[model samples]
Target: MRYACPTPGCPTTAPTRTTRCEQCTRRNSRAHKITLVCGPPCSGKNTWVAKHAQPGDLIVDLDALYTAVNANPTRTDHDQPAALTPFAFDARDAITNRLLHGDHNLRAAWIIHSAPEAATRAEWKQRGANIVMITADQDTLTHRAQVQRPNQWGEHIQDWHRRYTLGHVDRTVTTG
Candidate 1:
């Protein structure tokens, strides 16, 4: 007994009921796209995702997670106490791990991170993620930090620029 691959336009066949051919199976598994928006603090990573993301899309952002866990309903900014950083990080990791599984009901997943190392971007690529680097000049970022979070975010902005290295995924988006 033989079974034809159920995938449309796929001509492969198997001797047993293997739902789809190897090629189609691999392609299907990667149907859900994971996009990582990376850059320094105040680089508009969250804004970029907000502009592009649609309903049913999963968004994993540490700052947003932190705000949620902070449980401050009146909070209108991304600032969170340093004590809650670890907890927010753990939540982000859990969500990211689940997204990496490639079996979620989400249409797409967007992760906002400050990934400054080539190795980090390479790993994300290996896991079928698209890297989008949102950036701005150092002065602009520093100024934005000062205006937004003052002493809290300026150092992080400077650190990101010092460590960032353009990798194979050079989809850079300059933001104001």
Candidate 2:
């Protein structure tokens, strides 16, 4: 009898005594819907996910993860120390690997990241992820950064703009 693969989004059937199908073992298929939200620091990627994501859906945001792992209680989003960046990224990578190749009960996952390269976007596409690009005018981004983010965020915005390439994203959202 062919049994369904234990991996979350994999569709192949597994043989007897196997925990996952051969394809799944090779990490060939995605087990669920993965939406990759890409944008500058203050572009409302988190807001967009908050508005669209439903209950039980997995939402992975670096800032949120940083806050969760941060030692300080007074630190807010985007104010995390540089020392915590690696930990936050490691956590994100682990969760992303699980989403791509492991078992889970969630139906969908929303990943908030500032992916500014075409290669990164293409990699996500190959892994069966839908990419969404969030953007705002320079003035709007600057203004939002000044009000909502630290002074260094202006540099982040500029860096995103400098590196961002308009790739084959599934959706484009403009937020002021």
Q: Specify the highest-lDDT model's number.
A: 2
Candidate 2 versus truth, CA RMSD in Å, comes to 5.3
TM-score for each model: 0.79, 0.83
lDDT of each: 0.80, 0.84
lDDT by residue (tens digit), candidate 2, 40-93:
888889999999999999999998998888888777558878888899999999
For every candidate, C-alpha RMSD to the true structure in Å: 6.2, 5.3
Instruction: Indicate which candidate wins on TM-score.
Output: 2
Where is model 2 poorest over a 10-residue stretch in terms of lDDT? 23-32
Alpha-carbon shift of residue 95 in model 2 (angstroms): 0.5
Compose the digit string of candidate 1's lDDT tens values, residues 51-125: 999998889988889888997777657777788889998999998877765556677889898999988988787
Regions of model 2 farther than 4 Å from truth: 1-21, 25-32
Per-residue error at 103 for model 2, in Å?
Answer: 1.8
